[model samples]
Target chain A: MTRRVVITGMGVVAPNGVGLSAFETAVRAGESGVRFIQELADRNFACQLGAVPPLEASHLQVLTTLERKTLEASGIIYGLLAAVEAWSNAGLDVPGNEEDPDWESGCIFGSGIAGAEVMRDATYLIDEGRVKRLGSGAVSQVMASGISAYLGGRFGLGNRVSSNASACATGTESLLLAAEHIRSGAATRMICGACDSGGPYAWGGFDAMRVTNRRSNEAPEAASRPLSATAAGFVPGCGAGALVCEELESAIQRGATIHAEVLGGAINSGGQRKGGSMTAANKEGIVRCIRHAVENAGIHPREIDAISGHLTATLFDPIEIEQWSVALERSGSQFPYVNSLKSMVGHCLSASGAIEIIAAILQIKGEWLHGSLNCENLHPKIAECIDPERVPQTFRKHAVRTLAKSSFGFGDVNTCAILRRYDPE
Target chain B: MAPSRPDIIDRLHRIVEPYVEDEEALTSVDEDTNLLEDLSIDSMNLVDIILDVEEEFGIEIDDEAAEQMTTVGSAVDIIASRLAAAD
Candidate 1:
C-alpha cells in the first residue's frame, strides 16, 4: 500500500532568521530582509541585495568540525540547518534515528545557483592575481547539487540524494518529488527545500531583467510591496525552508508532532503557450495544477481555506495569479484567501516556493493568515485576493482544513502542492 | 556546382526526414527545400533538426553559423561550408 506523507517537523534559515520561531516573528512583524547592494556598487549595477542571516558559523560546529575557512556562503548553510532541525524534529538522530535509519532518510534539496561566493572568489583569484592560485574546491563548492550532496554526506542520508533545478520552482518541486517518493514506497522519509545565499549575481541578474525593486531606497523595509498597486518589483532575498515528510502511519507510531499533511501535489510544463511568452504566465497551467491537486486530495474546492501564492511582486506576474484566482472562482467556489509571502520576505527566487509552503504550513498550524504587508491598497482586479482581517497576533487554534501552495518558474513550470491539516491523535 | 555525394544526402535525409511527421508528402524533398515555411516544422522542431544534423555531419557549429542555418537549405549550405573550411 502507498504511504500517506505528512510534514512532521520543519526548520528554516530564511532571510529573517535561521529557525521557525525567528521566521514566524519576522513574518508576523512584516520584516524586510532586503538591503542596499554594497558589493554590486563595485560592479556598477543598480539593484538591491538580500542576504541570509549572518553566518553564526559556530552553529555548524555541532554538525561538522570543518572550520569556517571561507565565507563562500550559499543556500548550503540554510540547507544544513534545515536538515538538522528536520532530523531532530522527526525524533531521528544524526546518521539516522534508531527507528528509521539515515539510509532510509533521503535528502532532496535544491538551489538555482550554488556556492555563489565560490564563483565570486574564483573570479577574483583569476582576474586579480594568478589562475593557478584559484581555490581547488571552487568547482565542487559551486556545483548546483553541492547542497544536496553536502547534506547527504553530512547527515549520512543515503536513500535518495539529488537536486532539482527548475529555476524558481526548484524548492517546491523538491518537496513534491519527495512526497511522490513516499507515495511510491521508494523511501520512508525525506528532507526537501531550496535556498540561496543572497548576493550581487542574484541582484544583477534581476537588475538586467529590470525586475528588482529599487524604490524605497531610503526605506528598505517598504521596498517589497507585493499586491500593492504601488509595488515596483521584487526585492531579492535568500534562505532555506525545509520539512521532514514521512509516511503518516510511521509518524503516528513514532509519536511525531505532525505539522501538516502532504495531501497531494502536481507538476507540469507550461508548453509552447507559456514557453513563447516571457513575461506572460500561463493561467491554464496554474489552474490545471490546482485542479488536479484539489481532486487528488479528495477535497472539494470549498474546503480550501487559503492559497499561498508565488506572488513575486512583478507587474505581470501578480496579474497572472489573479487570472488563476478567476479560473478557480469559475469552478463554482469562492476564491480562497490568497496571500504572497514576497510582500513580507521579498522574493527569494528558488527559495520562494519552499518558503511560501512554509507559510502555508504555518497557516494550517496556526489557522490564520498573515496579512500582505506593504500592500497599502490592494490590486483592484483581485482586491479580494487576500483578506487583511485574517492576520492574527498568534498561531490560531482552529484547524485550517486545506491550503494550496503554488509556484511558477521561468520555463513555464507551474507546480502546486496541497497541504492539509493532519490530526495525530 | 551540384553536390555529387549521394551518401551525404542519404545520411542527412535519414536524420531529418524521420523527425518530420509527414514523410510521404516530403519523400522526394531536395536539399534546397525550406525546413520551416516549406516543411512546416516549427521553431522548436527546427532546433532538434539542428542537433541531429550536427551529430550526423560530425561538425561543430559556432554561434554565428547556428543562427545562419535557420532553414534546411541554409543549414545544408552552412554544413557544407563548415566542411570546406575544416578541410
Candidate 2:
C-alpha cells in the first residue's frame, strides 16, 4: 500500500503577508497586496503597479549578518524565509551542524528569477575589469539550484534535495512531486515551495510584453481584477510559499498536527500546440490535466467543493473558468464555488501556485472562503460559464471539504492539485 | 616595501571582518590567529579572502603562496613579500 502524504505545516512570504498567521488573516480579510512600485515607474515600465512582499532586509533574521550581506539573490532570501518557517511550523527542529543529516528529509524549493540581479551585477563587474572581486559566493548566488542547495545545507537534508522550474506551474508541481516522493517511500518529510525575485529586473520582461496591467497604476488595490469585466492584464507579483509534507503514518506517530492531506494531483504540458503558445494555454490540455487529477485522487468531479483557479486578471480568466467546468463535467448553477487569490495579491508568477494552495488549505481548515477581491462585475463570458453565486465576491463562512486548485504557467504547463481536510479515520 | 607588516595586518583585519564567524575572537586577533580554527572562517571562504586581498593590493598571490596563508602572520609574510617584489 502507498503511504499517504499530509501537510503538517505551512508558511507563506506572500505579497499580502509574510507569516502564516498574518497571511491567513490578510487573506480572510481580503486585503490587497498590489501597490504602485516607484522603481518600476522610474524605469519607465508600462506596468508600474505590482505586488511584492512587504518585507525589509531586517526581517530576514534567519541568516547570519555576514551571510545576508553576501547574499544578492532575492529568490534565496524569500525562499529561505518561507522554508525555514515551514520547517519550524511543522515542529521539526532546525538541525545543528553537529547532528547527523536527516536522511529521510528532503526539499524541492523552486525559483524563477533566482539570480537575475546577481548575474547583472557580475556582468557590470566584468565590464569594469574587476572579475577577481566577484567573491567566492558569487557562483552559488547565481546558480539555478541556489534556493534548494541553500535549504538542503541549512536543514541538513540528505534525500532528494533538488529544484525544479516549469514556469508558473512550479509551485503546485513541487507539492505534487513532494507528495509522490513520500507516497513512494523515498522520504518521510519533504519541504516543497517556490519563489520569485519580484525585483524590477524580474518584472521588466512581463511589463515589456504588456502582459501586466498598466492602466491601474493610480488605483493599485483594484489593479488585479480577475474575472471582472474591467480586468486589464495580470499585475506582476512575487514572493514565496512553502508546505511541509510528511508521511501520514509518521505524522500520526509523532503526534504532529495535520493541517490537510494531498490527495494526489496531475502535471502536464500543452506541447505549445493548438492555440497553446508561450503565453496562452491549450484548453484541451487543461481539461485533460484536471480529469486526470480527479481520477488520480480517486474521487469524482462532483466531490470538489470549490476551486482555486489560475485566473490571473487577463482575457484568459474566462477560458480557465470554462475549462474547469468542462473538466469537471459540471456547468452553470451546478458549478462548484471558485475563487482566485490573484484578485488580491496579483499574479505572483512561480509563487502563485504555492500561495494559492496554502489559501485553499486554510479555507478547508477554517471552513470559510476568502472573498475574491475585484472579481465583481464578472466578465460576460465568465458569467455564462459558471453561476455568479459560485464566484464569491466577499468572504463567507462555508464548508470546503475537497478544494481543487489549478495553475497554468507561461509555457502552457498546467498542474491541478486536490486537497482535502485531514480526517482521522 | 615602504608599508610595514603592521600596515598590511591592519588592512587584513578589515578584509576578514565579514568572513569570520567569531567577531570576539577577531577583535583580539594577532599574527598567530588561524583563519580556520581561531576566526572560525570556513576554508572555502579563504579563497574569497584571497580574492579580496588581491583586489585591495592590485597584486595576485599565486596558488602556491595562497595555500601557505593558514595564519594571519603567514598571510602577512606572503602579501608583504609580494609588495616588496612589486616595489
Candidate 1 local lDDT, A131-191, one digit each (tens): 5434344655688888888777666786999988887888789889999998898888888
Model 2 chain A scores worst on lDDT over the 10 consecutive residues at A57-66
TM-scores of the models, in the given order?
Answer: 0.76, 0.94
Candidate 1 Cα errors over 4 Å, as ranges: A49-51, A96-101, A126-132, A274-279, A330-333, A384-399, B1-87
Tens-digit lDDT track of model 2 for B1-87: 367888899999999998876678977989999999999898888888998899888788988999999999999999888888888
What's the DockQ for every one of the candidates?
0.01, 0.57
Worst 10-residue lDDT window, candidate 1 chain A: A386-395
| Runs off by more than 4 Å, candidate 2 | B1-14, B22-28, B51-68, B78-87
What TM value does model 1 have? 0.76
Q: Candidate 1: deviation at residue A237, Å?
A: 0.9
